[model samples]
Target chain A: MSTVEAYARRTARRGWWRDGLEAAIYLVAAVGVAFFVASGGLLATAPVDHLYGLGRVAGIVAAVLVLSQITLISRAPYVERVVGHDRAAAVHMRLGKVAFVLMLVHVGLILAMSARYDGRSILAETTALWQLGWFIPAAQAGLGLFAIVVATSLVAIRSRWRYERWHAVHLLVYAAIALVVPHQFLEGSTFRSGGAAWWFWLALWALAVGSFVAFRIVRPLWLLGRHDLRVAAVETHPDGSTSVTMRGRGLDRLGARPGQFLLWRFLDRERWTQAHPWSLSRAPRPDALRITVKPSGDASAAVRGLEVGTRVLVEGPLGVFSEVARTASGCVLVASGIGITPVRAMLDEAHPACTVVWRVRSRAEAPLLDEVEALAAERGARLVILEGPRGPGWGTAAGETLAGIVPDVAARDVYVCGPVAWADAVERDARAAGVPAGAIHRERFGW
Target chain B: MRGSRAVLVAGGCAAIVGAGWAASPKELPTLDLVAPSSPAASATPGATPSPTPTVSATAGATGASSTYDGPVVTNARGDYQARITVADGQVTDVQAVVAGTPDAQSVQINAVAIPALRDEVLAAQTWDVAAVSGASFTSPAFTESLRGAFEEAGL
Candidate 1:
């Protein structure tokens, strides 16, 4: 069978399983709201009752989406493999925005509903929110923290601040969720003990938080134990980029593939806390891994100065940008600037007939050019270097179309990694050239 | 593919909600136990009445007016208990022994509801009466508890 058909067939099974889990997420939430309805939620005729119901549903949905965000970023292997870390984080980010909206509505409606019931004004009910049970304030704080996180996470705001700042604010999402739990049981209409809603909600929370702890925290710690990763060497490239090589025992057991990335935390006193997501710049061996990065960010900048044998930790081998995800027999690997890191790695792993397209402002700007050319020559593959400032889209200033650069582009799987807007343009050109959506892959790390 | 996945998710949610609606016992099954002379009105038999759990009835220590507390009736909302005071077969006062709600609607409704229902029970001197509007759950539970209190008073 052709590689495309075999890969497609394999992913078809995974697609079903992934879709099932996705459906379960929605179902759990729907059932939560539905339990309220079946238990006379729909019977609310009064304004106060109606508002309460609306607020409760909003609260439940927001809660579900919130937990879903946790699960998405938890680095669950199945989720990361099927959806890819980028896609999962993308959905996670979008869900955070929606959850925030739902939460605001929840707070407003509940306050209004309470005012209606208590025969007071909305302003009058504000004090009662704090005076009520601890969960009330907790829910309030959860909403506030989500708002602050969302505010700081906006692209405009996020770019102005450091990634660590954004991330630290983001961690409050977990604290927010923890605070809201008390009210959900004590005051949540559907969460009476031993009821179907109760069990469903309890189970849903258990799954969300449990998956988070297991995947995000426990799994990484376990990998740290099993693999014993350390910085083998750090090399600075001519283009002001650095490649950090790490030697580890039993790295093959980690199941990492080419084009995949890991969250690297160099356990140095200067920056042991910050983690950066960097893709392997070369194919992985059983004993070693490598990642090339531009020194644009603080942590990336520190890569060139790392001492030899420095301890390291990783939560990785994540992303589905691999040969196994290919939907066609022929392949085209494309990269620009720092984006070439993964494409270089994939060249070693690509089939002999594959093609490589590397874009750089100048020959000096492209990191690993010699290695890339050598790898392409060794593999008997086609290679193209578009050395010039990028034109509109993922093209060089010479004004070359994607199809003009790659032979029979429509019949091959095209993998491109670059700036998001540039990648989107490349995808646009690929689709325009009749490349099927299934055959086009893009690697993006920032969520 | 994204569209299909969304449809699948929505469909699954609908099916789950449909199942919950189906599985939900909207109405309480008929209880063979009779409504005793005490003023315990029926909370929705929907929650199964927690096996006839009774709240302690407090009696007036001294005074012509005697007081009695009612059985605790629980629903999806929470537990409820009512107290009724009578002077020589004449009900003078009725108060919710344990009827405050964590929710605003319940509290607002009960703020007016329990007292209004209490006045109705006192004027009528019977548990059977029209439940005040907007506080249906609390009214019924209050009536049932009032019945238990009346029985305790031996009226």
Candidate 2:
């Protein structure tokens, strides 16, 4: 085998193994804290002190969970491959909520425990805790930032807030985590110098935060420096959307599969801080990558105005919506509107029995319809186009369904991308039609 | 992957709680090195003998080697125990061992303050030594721990 091909194969195998090891590491770190507490005589404590001990243990694990949230969302490549980028993000959000709740319980029970012993009211005890040191108040502020992140992320609230505003709050989680560190090292008894438990906690924090710095910070800077990526051309598609083709050297070595995405930061004087993740609208090429934007929001709308030589800083070619994720003999590519970008790209590598299902409100709304159709024909995949508004479901018409457009969709790996609700609808129908849950891949492009 | 994840999570949580029960301290634990001595332990009416004992008053040159376990004195900083060795009516040595963990700052603070405080007490040949400025609390706690040691030594 060629050296490059051999290295790719080995890397792929290691990625799968790392997923299981990641789980094992997470489990061990959390259990190690519990083990630390148990060794200190958890049950031998007065029945009343047991609550306090449990809270202390909860605090340790909650700290782990907080760090884990960062690790998962850092866009670490190995994790992205195992669960896919979208699922990693979804799990990141879910774990954030759980960690926050556990922390609240930890703080509440610890305060209550103190009150019981000090013979003071809970409120008075809380005041005492705040007075203990700068660490307690700092930790409280950290938890408060976490609350803001969780509050703004609520579905009802997130709809009203722009992605930039919500995301700005979301980024405070890093600061929240930093602010909480002193209390763990200074005040948390388990981390104090009695045993090796302190080292265990330190290692967990190092692994999680170190990965964040390496992948999110260092890797992006390296990619931007190495590739020297810039906009080679920006074309207004026949539809209202715009397509940006970026040029950089050695793009082929990026290992970006078709249907993957790049977190694109168009370094314009205006809105430079906003990064919109755009998927490849065409198969990844050797010296260039392309993304189609629909002008739907502030960031997307600004893409139409990007100068030809605009510098583009990218964090990925992330996500796993490709043929490598395929688990069936044939594949079904489903998309609506701009969602067709990934579907069009993936069609470049479609199998002989593959099928394409496109949903658009009208013919003009489909930007790359001609290219999609041509690709399908070349690969001998059936091309089914459905025009008109989506119905009660993700249907192209009032009563149309997946089985109607692609008769063998249930027998193939179905990749769906579009609006969040539309993609979810597709997944729901695919499952209802007896497709195994694992065979359906969808990316929810939401905050 | 999902099956494996489910198993890992369930087993992990079970292991945490199960190990928690297994590792907990036994009743009335031995506490070999030290325990965080409560304020109640020090404040009790007669737990400790009066500070003005005869051992410190006795004149020079006793040939016996004596070992004393000082009271585990806890302050805002944490707990500590000072082992005091006296020979020929001089305060031969004072070593303070912290009960729990001393954080980095405390470690540094105590590192400077403990030895100086010990020397001052040893030079004065008494427990009424002056406190160090940056380590006022530790100075007092160290003295208290030392006094507990002295009381055990009948001084």
Candidate 3:
């Protein structure tokens, strides 16, 4: 039997998890609306009642989406394992925007209805709402914080700001969520009526916040105390890339895959507050793990100057661009520029039937070509190199289709990593060549 | 794939909402605007009469006239206690002694709703009047307390 069919069967069984988790997110939001209907929302006949009812539904959905957003970024192991970190973050971003708009709608409709009912202006109603409960004002303040966070997160704004500054501002989202929570249970009539609805919301919140505290914060601290990871060696390549190897005790228990990236925070006086995501350039060992950085930004540029003994705090073993995501026995790994970091590590762990396609501006410009070539030769994997610029296809020449290069590409999983446009082209070619969507994996360079 | 997922999500939400609607209280109790003592009146048993009245009616000169305070009824909004002054077996006056949530919205709602409810009960001479519109919480709470007061006054 061909290895392709065998591998297909293996991967087909695991595909349900991603779909199931995605469905669960929407289902949870639906349950929120269910709670509202159960609370007689449908029976609201008057104009004021209708406005209030719709506002309540909007509030419920917004709150649920915010919780989902929190869960996505919580770095929960199961979530990361299933959906991958990049996809999770993308969904988080999408939901955050929707949640924010719905929140504004909630506030608007609620204030409009209240003002109309009370025979008062919107401003007067705002004050009246403030007087409703102490949490109301706190919730308003939370909305302001959320606005600020969203503003700074805009593409134009984020591109200009340093990552550390943007991240510190981003942390305000947690506080926004915290401030918004009290008014939900204390003032919202659906939750205020102590019953199954209330308990359901309470449990949902506990799950989101609990996962965040446990996985994002507590787990990193535990790793620091337990593994005691620190920089053991730093290597600077001729291509202006730096490789830092960190040695830690019992790193096998860290559970990091060969190609996964970790958010690294170096505890140097200058770099402690900034954490950058860097992919492992080699397979993890029992005592050490290594990451290579090509300085594209301020934080990454400073990595070459790190001292050997610098303590590293990490939140990861994240993303699914690894063997665990493979669906076939034979695989094709495609990478460009510094994108080779994860692809190189992944190639080291690929099956003997694997193939490597590396695209670079020039051989000299390739960051880790030596190590990758050595690994490819050792593993007996096919190696293909394309060097040039301005290609009609993913490769350097026009009409260079993926199927033409690798004739059996349809039966194998194709992993593409590089700049966004380059990766998109590769993915498009892979799809056109008859590879299933599930069999085509693309690792975006940055979040 | 994104389109299919959205359809699934929308379908799932509709199903959940359908289930909630199925389980919801189907019939909102419409107020039976007729006095219990009137020959033409057939009171909705739960709306006008409490099975166990908590207060006793004091004696009056003309058949039965007395003041009765209903037992406090609590809901999500807040506490509600209705006081009734009965003279000669008729409900002379009704007042919501405690009626509203701590929120300004609920307070404002009750201010308008309570007076309308009082007029309804006095005109009907029973607690079986319809809930005032836009005051879903306060109206039900008011009627619940008024029902207890009616049973106490034996009217």
Candidate 4:
């Protein structure tokens, strides 16, 4: 079979998995509301009762979205494989905003309805609710924590804080979820019945939280135990990037492909608290994995100072900017500045009809240039270097369209990894050159 | 694709509304403004039917009538008491009353639950009825009170 045919079949199958995952999210949310309806929520006649019903539905949807947010970021292999890590995290962020808003609506409507029903002021009803049971008060506390987490996550606030601080605040989401869960089962009329509705919620929570613990926490610890990875050597390049080579046993078992990144935590005193995402600068071998990090942040800068034999914990081989995402026989790999790490690693295993396009300000300052050039020559692949200041197009020269350079650009899959704006320009040019949207894969270099 | 997405959204909304409307009861039970029946006459159950009611006699002349108020049961929410009226060895009516610290939420819960509990008790003619939904405190209190009333009547 030809490469395009095989690629087509693989993508079609993967497309099903993506569709199924998306459909599951919608289905679970719908089922949540359905449970409320089954409990006769829609039968409410009074204005307060109607508001109470709305609160219940809002709470149910919010619960579903929250669970979904957990599942998306759980780093579950199946989810990452289907949607890619970047897409999953993007969805996670979007769902988080929606979930938080619905949560507020749920709390507000429930309070208003209770106040009206009891013929008391809202403040008085809140006090009464606090005295009602332990779980109600616990849920309120969780809501407060949620408010804090969300406030810190806002773009304006988040930009003001360091990544480590922002991340520590974000971890409170797990605690918030734990605190809020008890009231869902204990207080809701539908759930209290201990019937199908109860089981449905129980199973959903188990599935979501279970995946989170199993994949995000357990799998990494297990990998750490099995691999026993430690830094073997560190090389500082002329362009201010540091490449760390780590030696480990049976490293090939990680199933990491070229152009994939991992969240690396160097277990040193100074850098133990932060895990930075860095792509492998070379193809994985049985005994070693390497990462090239450009010093963009404090944690990244500390990579240059890492001592030999420093223990390491990793949470990937994540993302889909690899051969697994290809949809054509020929392929074009494009990179700019530090983005060349993944592209260089990918050249080692790319298709025979591959072309490497490196766009940089200067050849001497480009990281991993020599390695990519050597790999291109060894594999009989063409190389194109565009070095100069930014131009009107993706290329550094005027009228240098993708089609003008790589004549058969439309016949090849295009893989782009770089700064967001440069990558966007490359994608626009690739599309203008007649590349199908699905055939153009991008791995953006930031959170 | 945009057309399909719009259709999908519209269909989802319709399904949700349709399912909710279908699941709802034909008519919701409205809150009763009138006070419940006052305490019935308390009397021993007789093997032979006879008029033996002493206080507030409102029953038929033949059957002996007994009504007992269950001791107030306290839960986290508040206190609940069950009052049951028995005639001819059958519990004809049951009322769940919120006593102390009647939290407004509990009041709303009892309003909906009391009627459901009454139907359950009348249908079974016993104290053992399923707990009403959303009335965790009131259901058990009502059951405890009804059980005491039943034992006292010796039916």
Pairs with backbone N, CA or C atoms under 3 Å apart (clashes), candidate 4: none
lDDT of 3 by residue, B1-155 (tens): 36776788779878998888877655332322222322222222122323333443567565665667665665545556677888867888787656643343465557678889889999999898998865767788789888888877777
- Model 1, global lDDT: 0.76
Q: Where is model 4 chain A poorest over a 10-residue stretch in terms of lDDT?
A: A40-49
Give the poorly placed runs of model 2, Cα more than 4 Å off: A1-22, A38-45, A130-132, A155-158, B1-155
Tell me the lDDT of model 1 at A311: 79
**By TM-score, how accurate is candidate 4?**
0.85
Scanning candidate 3 chain A in windows of ten residues, the lowest lDDT window is A39-48
lDDT of 1 by residue, A266-356 (tens): 8889877777888999989989999998988777887898998887888878888887678778888887788988888888877786888
Among all candidates shown, the one with the greatest lDDT: 3
TM-scores, all models, native as reference: 0.81, 0.79, 0.81, 0.85
Better of 3 and 4 by lDDT: 3
Task: Single out the weakest 10-residue window by summed lDDT for candidate 1 chain B.
Answer: B28-37
lDDT of 3 by residue, A70-136 (tens): 8888999878887888888888989989999999999998888766654568997787776556899
Q: What is the lDDT of candidate 4?
A: 0.79
Give the distance in Å from residue B37's predicted Cα in candidate 2 to where it truly belongs: 18
The lDDT per prediction is 0.76, 0.73, 0.80, 0.79
**Would you list the rank order by lDDT, best first?**
3, 4, 1, 2
